[model samples]
Target chain A: MANGELKLLGTWCSQYVIRIRMMFELKGLSYDYIEENFANKSELLLKHNPVHKKVPVLIHRDRAICESLVILQYIDENWSGTGPPVLPANPYDRAMARFWAVYIDDKLPRQLIDTLKAATEEAKAEKIADIHAVLELLEGAFNKCSAGKVFFGGESVGYLDVTLGSYLAWIKAEERIVGAKLLDETKVPLLAEWEKSFLAADCAKKFLPSVERVEEYVRELLVTKWKVTSA
Target chain B: MANGELKLLGTWCSQYVIRIRMMFELKGLSYDYIEENFANKSELLLKHNPVHKKVPVLIHRDRAICESLVILQYIDENWSGTGPPVLPANPYDRAMARFWAVYIDDKLPRQLIDTLKAATEEAKAEKIADIHAVLELLEGAFNKCSAGKVFFGGESVGYLDVTLGSYLAWIKAEERIVGAKLLDETKVPLLAEWEKSFLAADCAKKFLPSVERVEEYVRELLVTKWKVTSA
Candidate 1:
């Protein structure tokens, strides 16, 4: 690799990793994608992200940037001229984008994981309800943010889109495993519609892993890591 | 208030709120600070931040930007030509600053709270050890980021300084309550020195609450919220 070359350390099943991959595609930036195995994390990943030791570390010019959201912001700032800007141009809009992106990361993933980890039928139902509540809040956010525009970035997929859209596969996989519809069209029509459109996007198609693949990974996670047998 | 006027919905004791206050002072921006009661949170705060309903909500031109970190970035972007830049001009430096800021927020406060809420001496000792480990890492970060300079922002206080600096009062309070020197001079000498310099800075003196106030608040929080009896 040449000096100033971009390289991403990630895994296939990670939504956080997928977010960066999607961003790279969106920017039309070419880079080497180094896949990491979670079971046996590479020294590069460990050295780069000593704190979390998590994947989706973006190595640019031999300097590593860890955390998915942080990586996304770095890419946007570093390659501002090369891409359709990841964050909004206006300061207030940018704040809102950051706010919602953080919200999605804080709420959705944990709730989705809880829904999977739920032992009893009652617990699963309760967790599913919590997920719906979060989705409803996000639905309101979508309406407020989009402002009758197609995407959160208004006619372009930006930061929030990648943040939330990265989880679509997992959401679908969870839905399949739990035998429930997490993103019901009737409840959150806009998000349901947005999902279709986001999935249809060129970058998303190139980067997003298959729902089946995520489903398999999640099932294994439940069995091996979580110590719960699949239904 | 005129259009684009700033109003901060916050409580004095909140370190999250202190961060924004410090940022405002650093930027030399004036704003109306509305004190909120946590026991019965103000409707204004609830209205502004419907999702979190938590403060340090920066209401600019009547548009609310919730979350301290988000608000800090917004202030930086909106007032790019202000007194001092909150974030670094260089992209990679900005990313590093952000990474450390996030790490500080993720580790410190929670560990401090756990230390207070620890039911046993062993638990408290473990939590204290965890905090020391985090501080040790932050000491390394201070060296890496400062690079022979006084502050994390190098020549002046920037994003990372304000972020980790906001928790100074709480750290002091935790030290007092637990009878443990959290920022030990011997262990994390760099952070200890940095703390003194940061506290002596103009913005910190103006914004940071007294250590006694924070100690009282934390003790009360222990009794009421966590149901833990402070020693």
Candidate 2:
């Protein structure tokens, strides 16, 4: 239905990029994915997203949309007729979906990274506590909002599923690199089950980066930039 | 039209709270505003926003929504029939509105705070330069998006207006505390003009905090917490 070329600029291992890709697959839309080199960014990436100059920029008919969650909303809204709507039809539910997505995107990712890059044992412990607190909150949110539902979207993988699902591989990678178990099944049983189902979903199976690749990237990052030896 | 009681919990000086108040006024919605004491927050505020423990939490029909942008979207969507839609109807335009709002909410506010808190003159100068670069980008965005229009929403004040307008008073206060003119007319004429029109609007004039009060708060913050006497 789209009249013009739809191009996506992203890195292979970025969770944000994975989000857009998964959304496209779920929506059954076709688009070209251009893998951007972080060391040497392309002119197209820079030209499209001059402000952030970051990845996961969606170019539709040459109109670029940056930020993953924003791109997801754009994709859903533009393709409302064809795809299962990423946001709920009800206003309140849409707000709730957005609220959870923001929590997953803004809060969880940074905390996970910080847990990995903690400078000292004390800091790591504190960061782990913070992560647990966040997880508990999300666990409650998911359990309360998603009762007997296959996904946060109900019946199928919704916006929240795509959002948190994008980070599944990274979370696993952090488990190996950080040597801390964040998503303990006992603590967050619902999320644990949801993660399993999410990964097994057709879209996730295709788009999610391999756990080994994510682990390697994390290990390399720690050694080269943070000057830490993987234990 | 609505059945439930609407209550807003906010601090006196927060720009975010002011955004909601302005929206309420523009929409002609009657709601109770409960001023939150930052030093000794009420149990209600804590309960509603457990994760953030922050202000500007809106209670509609006993459902609490936190985060300024999320609250704004909630308000807009719930009251779509009454007020001018905060987000444009077009999907692309909605994405644009959200993109700019994120930039204003996430990027600009923290940078401005950092510019104020910089200890050394050299660091302050660097922060000021960074702020200028951000302003130049915003200037271009506002000018391009708001061509021949009074606000970013086109005819009347829209989402971007509310997002940026909330910070208008705080920006004025920063000018006094930092003692370096940031939003000079020569540098950002469009924004300067928009600022005047925004503050003069009935909604803004009534809801926005006074420059004197914001300056006083900054003065107290520097003296008691930051340990810096104003230059």
lDDT leader: 1
The sequence of per-residue lDDT tens digits that candidate 2 reaches over residues B1-231 is 354489999987898899999888878888888999998999999999997899999998888998888888888988889867878888888898899888888877788888888988899989988888878888888886787688877878888888889888888899887888788788888888888888888889898889999999888887887777644
Best by DockQ: 1
What value of lDDT does candidate 1 attain over all alpha carbons? 0.90
Q: Measured against the native two-chain assembly using Cα atoms, what DockQ does each of the candidate structures obtain, in the order listed?
A: 0.94, 0.80
- Pull out the clashing pairs in model 1: none
Tens-digit lDDT track for model 1 on A51-129?
A: 8999989999779999899999999999999978989899999999988988899999899988888999999999999
Alpha carbon lDDT of residue B231, candidate 1? 63
Candidate 2 global TM-score: 0.96
Deviating ranges (above 4 Å) for candidate 2:
A1-4, A119-122, B1-4
Query: What TM-score does each prediction get for chain A alone?
Result: 0.97, 0.95
| The TM-score obtained by chain A of candidate 2 when compared with the true chain A | 0.95
What TM-score would every model get versus the actual structure?
0.97, 0.96
Distance (Å) between predicted and true CA of B91, model 2? 1.1
